[model samples]
Target: MTATEFIKKVFFFEVLQGLALTFKHMVSPAVTRQYPTEKREPVPGSRGLHALVRDTETGKEKCVGCGLCAAMCPSQCIHIYTSEGEDHKKVVDRYEIEVLRCVFCALCVEACPFGAVALSEVFEYSGYTREEFYYTKEMLLENWDKNMAGEKGRIYFEKFWRPKTVDFGAPALVKTEERKTV
Candidate 1:
């Protein structure tokens, strides 16, 4: 209606301003990473993949099959079956985690009194089928074995944000027995 408004409309002043902003960003530094080639390190307390911790002494699973992790999982993705071992201690018969249903809440990590389970930094595990996502106890243990080959004791757990009193026990001074063979 006004002369100024008419000039702006005819000249497309707002469109020019938007174009200028676009041009500015085009020449600026890229914020996105070149994924696959350059992977970014996961930030502290980032919940990625679940792994079972192995005991230092016997090179066995640290989980006593207390079923705390299964009970705490809000998504109900965790399943555990325990049976009495020859030593009279409760042993984990089966542990399965449906990765597709997991919420990555890290509650399972917090609920384990023995710190047998932890979320790792390996977030790239993807598959075409649902069967690939269903991680059994052996698969989870294999993940831990592969991911934590050279690291000294629970790396992700140490970086995880939690209370000082929440003890996952001391780190193993010696490397796992399996690692020594390789």
Candidate 2:
């Protein structure tokens, strides 16, 4: 062994360094939030539970029963049943979501053309039975009313859920080719 290695072994420099780190941490302030009494705000676009948006004018669900959300879901947790109405328009008979099976990917939100479905900020939902997690049309609408209504829902869609398309209300910046002089 070299002389430096011998000195380190005899003085236990590595052990002292480890203890110093431990002691430093012991004196440091606790970073953990008391989860029950104190809650941290969820970041924008953070996916949690699912909700169906309601049309403000009609006060009914905004879902047109297009089934795009179901088609886009990777987990296949969304289900929608639609039939012909008396006026020959499509009517949604049922809308169900297996919340337990949902992967919270938020693809359903992006696939919706009408901005009907949204992932709410509520992550505290818990239930003992599987049936409680099964959300129906009414339940989803209620979820929106409870957790994502008004300004909060609007901000969520505007900041996170809305798809960025070419016609998304922004002025296009087109570059023109310059003519070359001979």
Candidate 3:
């Protein structure tokens, strides 16, 4: 062995260096937050939980029972059942979500043409039983009302969600005669 390497091994240089690092870290300000007392705010547009949007005019959920959300879901966590109402309109009988199985990919929100579903900024939900995680239509609507009710919901849709197709600016078309051949 080299003399320097033998000296380092005998003097416990590696252990001393590790101890120095530990002490340095101990003296430094703590980066860890006291989670229970000082909970960190969730980032805007962060996918946390699911919610169904309400139509202001109708005062009802905007979901058309089209099943597009169910079809688009990568995890197949969403389920919608439709039935004809008294007026013979197709109404959503049930809109159930298996929260435990959802990947929070937000594909369902993107797939909705009616702007019915949204991912809320609520990340603090917990349950002891699987049944607690199974959300019904009422529960989703309640979430929308409680968390993303007014201006916040509108802002979320405008800022985070994809823009409407009509809002896109199309390029101007050029005449065929004006095009030069390469």
The best candidate in terms of TM-score: 2
Stretches > 4 Å off in candidate 2: 163-182
Q: Write the per-residue lDDT of candidate 3 for residues 91-141, one digit (tens) a residue.
A: 998999999999999998888876789999998899899999999999999
Residue range with the least summed lDDT across 10 consecutive positions in model 1: 157-166
Count residue pairs with overlapping backbones in model 3: 0
Candidate 3: the clashing residue pairs are: none
In order, the Cα lDDT scores of the candidates are 0.79, 0.85, 0.85
Clashes of each: 0, 0, 0
lDDT of 1: 0.79
Cα lDDT of model 1 by residue, 24-123, tens digit: 9999999998999998876544677888887768788888898988999999999999888787989889999999999999989898877788787788
| Residue 174 displacement (Å), model 3 | 28
TM-score computed on alpha carbons, candidate 1: 0.77
Q: Which stretches of candidate 1 lie over 4 Å from their true place?
A: 149-153, 161-182
> Candidates' TM-scores?
0.77, 0.86, 0.82
Q: State the local distance difference test value for candidate 3.
A: 0.85
**Which candidate model has the greater lDDT, 1 or 2?**
2
Clashing pairs in 2: none
Better of 2 and 3 by lDDT: 2
